[model samples]
Target: MQAQKFDLVSPEFKRNPFPVFSEMRSCGSIVQAKLPLIGRVWMATTYDAAVDMLRDHERFPQQAVRNGKKNVAGIKWWMPKALKVLTNNMLLQDEPDHRRLRGLVEQAFMQHSIEEFRPRIETIVDQFLDELELKFKQSGSVDLIEHFARPFPLAIICELMGLPDEDRPMFSRWAQGITNSGSIFSFLSMIPKLWKMNGYFTQQFKKCRVNPVPGLLSSLVSAEQDGHQLSEDELLAMAFLLLFAGHETTVHSLSGSVWTLLQHADQLEALQANWSNIDLAIEELLRFLTPVQMTKPRIAAMDMEFHGQPIQQGDYIIALLAAANCDPEKFDRPEVLNLLRDPNPHLAFGSGIHVCLGLKLARAEMAIALEKLFSRFPKLHLAVPEKELQWKKMLGLRSLLKLPVKLA
Candidate 1:
């Protein structure tokens, strides 16, 4: 008999998707099913198939119509009337445009550029830790998610974009308003919030146009090579993408990583023993945490067979990165948290030309933050029991709602 079809928005599936994914993976590497909100979508579980689908830009096009549609019912009405204004983004564009946009933005992410920001990042981490210490002293307990995880990434990204320090709080609100992944209404509510952000950025862009600095936004504004200049809409779209994508994922990763570490004290101790091994620990943590659980929906550009299952042209495929990362075939003792595990090929940042552009910056922030956090608060332990920790449910992103830790 055939197995039941999987539904992405079903209450049971939303509460815990791993069991459904496990059943599907057991049947085959690839599975076809209908989602609740989304009509028909292919689900890929195995590492090989996931990588194949991600790497093949020809067979799986990223420029599907669904890319621009924000999955919110009223987003169309709320956003600018000109569809071109919203759709001309790197995330929604195909090559040549994608390549051109990425090339211009790549300069800000070069190795030397990232290294230059290390000192500033370290300072930011220190400030957060200092505040955490103060709170621990005052109240004897603190929520790490609010005090540290959320603010660290927001401050860093805001500074990178050349936004003033006073504007950091507004940036945080705008980001949450735009990226909240609950109901479609939650996403729709962000339209007004994003409009505010857009207006703020427009003013900033104009300021840079007159007196530009060497920041990411300014660089993009001034970027011109061989008479190729990014269009005004493209610049706005890139700004939205960078601000939303750059900070939110890293915030989730940090929160999830800390929660995972506290749960697995032995692994945390092992990393504390040799700080040099933190890099490997970060990779393993990233693999285990899998912050971004669902892959962006990709449409099959042509008729193809995904692991022998026929997929028609223009079909939406949702690759489960979290499940693939934990596949036993890909890693030994997939559930075990081994900080020293080598050859980790996890797709936490994703796989392909459209892979995360801020990956390096994310890693740098995580590494520095972990080093400072663990070093300063070696006796740091969760204030509440593991089971009492609250995990965000019915959301695409896997993250802890609150992580209360006490600094010794």
Candidate 2:
């Protein structure tokens, strides 16, 4: 029997997606599905399929033009021209372009480089927690999303990008606009904000060129100026990609970890009892939570059979990362949240060359944030009933609208 089609953006899926994902896996490793803006495409529903699809760049390239087709996955006719600046990022590139774009700023996100920022991240996390504590004292409750989740990573990314601290709030506004892109109409609504953001990036690039700063942006600007490494559009695209992606995913990852832990009190207490294995525990949380559910759409490079599904050249392919993370074949009792599930190879950060660039920074930020949050508020509990918690209606993201918690 065919599995029932599911709307990724629907509240039902957001509330409890495991059952639907299970049904999808039962059908096959690959399934045909329709997305809000991207129409019909193949979805990699199991771990093996996700790995296969993500790693096979030759067969399934990100740039559709490489497949001898012109139907770009997410780009649409109605999309504002200005928005093209953001899509020119490395995420949508293939081969030489991808390698070239990635190499330009890869050093800053390397393990050792991110490790150097650990102390700074801890200070920032502590400062935010201190404010959260004060807010809880004054108001008797605090929304973790509003008070900590949204601003914490934003501050870190802004500081890393050499963006002024005062402009951090404006970036949050722009981030919110991007998160609401679930449907064509909603996406259209965000165009104006995106245009404004693009303009802001242009201004920042100009500033960096005139007076080089001490962060990643200035370095990128220098790369562009010296021997014309990055083009004007690519520079703007990189800025948008780094600033937007740097914080947006981390925000949901941090908040979702907190929510999941609160839901599974046993796991929460287990991790709290032994903070040394936080790195392991976070892997489990990332797997269970599955932030950034689907990967960026990959286009088929030729007519081929992918896990028994005949995919035409240029047909859009997306790895249902959230589904793959929970595949029972890969993970034992996949539905259960296991904090110390070692060898837990989850695709939360994807696989292969196109994998997340800021993964190291993201992991470090999450570790510090989670450690301090629980240690500081041992009595922290949800302010509202668990069922009352509302998630945003955005597709490809599992973000809580608010995480109200009480502090003793």
Candidate 3:
């Protein structure tokens, strides 16, 4: 089949993309396509294809080689140097470099470490719920994204990284300005925010070196493993990745989880009746929602035929995580949301070596957020009709612009 093109970032597509993905899957497991700002690429649409491409790093590496030069992701040759630095994170590396960078701070995100973080996350979640309660009482309604969803995870991630609480609001501003880079104009407009973020992170790094405060920043500053240490540029890249990924994705996950439950009153009631295994419910939501829609652009490592499609060296490929999660071959009634889906092998956090480092923490936060939310506000309902809800037009992320809710 010829390379296909579609508006993946359009509001219409953002609202419901499964049918489009289904069409793509019917054509082939891996179909060639074109994405804005990323150029022609292959999109892995099925569970098996997605897993194979993600695991076969040798054929499609995170780092790319073009014109005898190495580049990361789909970065253009003329893009600004600052943008390149931000994209040069561990998520876009391969092999030894990826392993070395990941090892530096892996301990803090381990399952045991995240488990210990439960009480603190609970405290934070409750605090946000309390604030939401006050706002709801005063106004009779609240935008969950503003009052709770966005700030809640941002606060947790900032605190976890030892950033000042006062700076939390600015991070959101920067994130909003830069999250959707589907167009060249939008991409260029975020340079200022990028500059500010880079400057702020640099100052924090210096402070850590001089005074050595607590949190991940301090640990990363002094962290060394096997005689390997992070350089200043790498430090900036790593910090950006963690801060953005740690909170931004969770913001959507939390908000989307609430929206999903509100849509399915039956599932909501079922969960409220028994909070014993809310983790199961959260997993199902993760699969059903699939917040981060696409994997980082992977470069074809060599010329080869993948599932009968001829792929040339330097071609780009992206695994559609949302599509893969809902592949009918993998899940029974993949379109339906089952709260108690056991053995749910969803790729929401992805698979292979580049799997999300914060999966455990994210899952914990979601579970806690859901449990505390419903327990406190069982009568909660949407303030506006579902059809009027808005989803951000950001590529590769499934985020709600706002989730207005009424607390009764």
Please identify model 2 stretches exceeding 4 Å from their true place.
1-4, 108-112, 224-228
Candidates' lDDT values, in order? 0.78, 0.86, 0.87
TM-score of each: 0.92, 0.96, 0.96
340 Cα displacement, candidate 2 (Å): 0.8
Model 3 poorest ten-residue lDDT run: 66-75
Candidate 2's displacement at residue 11, Å, is 2.2
**Model 2 over residues 1-408: C-alpha lDDT tens digits?**
232457777667887889889888877889887776777778899999999999988898887765765647655555667787687789988888888889887843442388788899999999999999999989999999989999999999998988999999999998988787766777778888888888888899899989988788888877532344788898889999998899899999999998888888988898899999999988999999898899988988888888998888878889999999999888999999889899988999999898988888898999999999999887789999988988888878988888999977
Q: Backbone clashes in each candidate structure, one number apiece? A: 0, 0, 0
lDDT (10s digit) by residue, model 3, range 1-408:
688876677777777888887888898989988877777789999999999999998887887754223555445565678767876899988888898899887954442377677899999999999999999989989999999988999998898898999999999888877786667788888888888888999999999999987688888888888887789999999999999999889989999999999989998898899998798998999999999999998888788899878888888889999999999999999889899999899999999989999998899899988898889999999999999999888889988899999988
Q: Whose TM-score is higher: candidate 1's or candidate 2's? A: 2
TM-score of model 2 relative to the true fold? 0.96
Tens-digit lDDT track for model 1 on 1-408? 233476544445533456766777887887776554455677788888888888887777676654443432222444455433653578756687788889888865552387889999999999999998898899989999889999999999888877688988888887776555466667667667766766777788899899987578888888875688777777888888888788889988998888778778887888888899988888998888788887777777777677888887777787778888888888998868888899999998888888888888999999999989989999988998877776655445776778899887
Q: Using TM-score as the measure, which candidate wins?
A: 3
Question: Using TM-score as the measure, what is the rank order of every candidate, best first?
Answer: 3, 2, 1
Cα lDDT for residue 302, candidate 3? 84
